[model samples]
Target: MSPDLYTVIKQICEEKQIPEESVVSTVELALAAAYRKDFADKLQNIHVTLDAQTGNFRVFDMKLVLENVSARIKEEALKLARQKKKAALYMPEFHDHDDEKFNADGVDLNDDDKLIEEGKVLLKFNPRTQITISDAKKIYPDIKVGDEYKEELEVPGDFGRMAAQTAKQVIIQRIREAERSIVFNTYKNREGEMVSGVVQRVEGSVVIIDIGRVNAILPYREQMAGDEYRIGGRLKLVIARVEMTPKGPEVIVSRTHRDLVSKLFELEVPELESGTVEIKAVAREAGSRSKIAVVANEENIDPIGSCVGQRGARVNAVIDELHGEKIDIIEWSANDEKFIASALSPAKVDSVEILDRDERRAKVTVKAEQQSLAIGKGGQNVRLAAKLTLWKIDIVQSETNAVIEISDDEPGDDTENVSQ
Candidate 1:
């Protein structure tokens, strides 16, 4: 209970990593609270000061020196006069000595001689507080009265015991708020980037991830399909967005964002990172299929092969990161016909003729045997091709002999003359 307040404050500040000034303020407030417990609420108006050097604190009831004392002893009249006087004098610029012994002409002498007598006559009193000088010097031998000091008040042994339980609750609440802010800020600007995190827990389909210092919300909607999350698992994810709230920040994280695919490629493909190979566009069904169109800015580098790596090792690593999501890397072409042809890969085509490039529609004639492969199971292949090439493609069997008609407004134009 008689611990050195200065050392106690310093130790607390160091332990909590809080500034010394903040610890001083917290101690001052705690003493104010103890004073309120010991005295009436009116004493709440009393100011408590802390000895910064000695860490001793005390309370003082300050009053203004005024003339014309009333003897009525009617507390009601005294209260009214105090209220009116407080209003005029205690504006924004009110100071401690404003109410100290001043004459009717507003002159004051800095002498404590009128202390007891003046205490009765003053209609307006401004209470000020500070740690007692005796207590301050006990904590720090170098401290003295009239010298400003910050004092740490001891929370009573009983209160300390109770606070052990209460502090846990209070700290837990405060920490959650602080952590939310940390998480929010960390992920808010990482919308299109990948972040590594530790899995803290799982709630149903959602995973609560510790993305460094804060818990990022990994919703089921953003998780890769069929990926199971176990507690304490490490994850690499894309930050979806950060949301603000009254308490703190909320971060939404995703494994399924299209950027996740691109980011993985960036991590895996050295050529892409060096800017020799550029990922022109990416379309993903997420956890099912994804297609990326890449171009070689440097002519010597084969963009598709570079992304694929030797024997499909690089792209396979990306697929494993995505929990076995299928990836197709296609060469990007400036020619719409060539690009569309590549977009629908692994299927041989007879020929492709542009029905309307501006309208983003094209007709392709594939061998009857390649029709099923071009269309794919459940039309996934062509759908991905549309998204990848940014064009609408209609695959027709060459055996059907069906001609893809252009608008009648067009004059004689031979479709075969179109370049591949």
Candidate 2:
């Protein structure tokens, strides 16, 4: 390779963070495609190798030996392929790498179950890269089925301008595709994990963030209420999902997902990270308040204390990240009644009765003075408690004994037994 070309490739590998081997292989494939487009026939199995150490080229016409297919079958397939109208049954011109067609079971091959049951090795032969056993025996007597037969071809001295242009296009396109794959995989594995990013720009309600590898988007639905995403401001976020668009991979980051709190706690508390303490459940109303339940695996460790930190340092950090949103950490209990009571924190439950075990319905009674505290502003407390426990909770004031339920679907509907 030329020193200039080597330097450029090295720079590209460093900047793109792509493997050198992948780039080199891509270059070789692009060169092969260009050579085929300019100098080879259609369906010709063309192979080209380029030496990195000392810029040298090798060209080959590669073919695979067909074990059971005969020349007569090849003739029939070619004939059918030429007849355009009758080609669907033979799946003519439907070529993968070898430009060959396979018809298994001849049933509606679309049905996966039937195809797997009755399917067998069936080939509509292509004469280009596949050679019959008899023809291969004549060329090389000891050649075996499924073995590659390579014929050395003379290398051309120079490629035309059009072919060179095609190679450049292929190299650009392939490198872009590789980069997209890398981004998709990197963010896909990070779903439900915390990531920090700088606000790049805002497109209406959607805020775009620059997160090192890719530009992740925080859509309107995932944004916390009253949260400002000012340009160049840094924010902690969790990746909700990664999807591939026609343009590229779209990394959907969220600040409102319940997992965001779990991840934040994990970062703040070493006990949570080390498995001494775990977050049992979390229910969040973004930018307002959240309730989380914690459990301890070790007897000596206090899960609540670990999450709360010394004088509220750990949870304060999470609250700061959430833009002053309130968080209530409660001890998780195994007893259903106790857990339901604890789910409604700060209310001082008088009693908890499982009204319907099958439907996960519970009745929580509190003193008349504590009724508003249990319901919270616009019934947010009871709403989050019901969500956190995955139970339909009915709040009853002991003095009046009137049951009231918070409807999470229709916000502000604190109707009696409306049920979320």
Candidate 3:
């Protein structure tokens, strides 16, 4: 190999953000595979090492040092080998996990030489890979069982056209595998955090966004109402899930997640990170409205005011990010009654009567004029308040003594309230 080969390997490592050791190991494996593809018939412990400075290859045929093998253990191995043949014809789902670990002949992996079962050592005899301790002492003076014994082999120059193509395919396959691992780990740690992305395209109901290293999928359900996903448009999304699929890493992002509200606040308000003010709970209806409850650790600091910023600059920044969605920032109280009343903001509550403490149900009586405000446009206010407090709320009119209905999920819901 020319010295320029090292320069090419360095360029690949820098571009892919992969470690130098990993890339060099991949090259060595490729060389060993190419040599085996043309010459070797059976599996052998082939180890290939590349010199970084000179770009040279050194090949070795390695064997495991085994103490002994019993005839019973050998019979068990033969039985299992027959079972594998039966599986190829009939049983398809007999094995689920990958056989990569068990295939240690040419594949470099971490495992002991012997298979130990129930305090007994089970050894499978393979003359090609394993050597007996008494026979091994003839070749070497001091060699212990369970240790590896290696003999240097000549590096072959010429493999057929097919074998050379196989080596190229292996390099490409391993590079792709390494990239998938890097992208999956990088975004999995950022779950529930906001990320900046550009709209790549809309595939039916799902919108794909280019987020730095990878593309994130924003499903139709996660997209906010009235939100436009034009191509090349910029967006701020929260990572909801990161999973590996047969193809590659799947990053699911959301605009309608409740955490988006609190995450946005953390960006605009520096106090949230200081331990001075803390956000207690967030209940969001995504595009239309959101309710956030916050508490102050110190008596001198006002949590809601701190979030609202000077003349509402802080909260306004969050609202702009949400595409002008309305926000209700209320002070969190330890008392359930006071907290429940506060959750239904812009609605004056005359009294809060805990109907069933065990059930976490409450009856809130508001002034006759404030009833409409409390119920919002078709009970949206009461519904969001219910979600924020995690309590079932009933809106009652102080004057008419009539109970109003509410729905927890549906918007514009006018269901009747049974509570008195």
**Which candidate number has the best lDDT?**
2
TM-score, each model? 0.58, 0.85, 0.83
For model 1, the stretches where C-alpha displacement exceeds 4 angstroms are: 1-182, 401-420
RMSD per model, one decimal: 12.8, 6.5, 7.6
Positional deviation of 329 in candidate 3, in angstroms? 0.6
Top-TM-score candidate index? 2
lDDT of 1: 0.64
- Report how far off residue 146 is in candidate 1 (Å): 34
Q: Which ten residues in a row have the lowest lDDT in candidate 3?
A: 85-94
Q: Which pairs clash (backbone N, Cα, C closer than 3 Å) in model 2?
A: 1-55
Residue 248, model 3: Cα distance from true site in angstroms:
0.9
- For candidate 2, the 10 contiguous residues with the lowest summed lDDT are 83-92
Better of 1 and 2 by TM-score: 2
Residue-wise lDDT of candidate 1 within 40-81, one digit each (tens)? 233123345678677555654432322222233223334433
lDDT ranking, best first: 2, 3, 1
Q: Write the per-residue lDDT of candidate 3 for residues 367-417, one digit (tens) a residue.
A: 989999998885778998887777888889998888975535445211221
Ranking by TM-score: 2, 3, 1
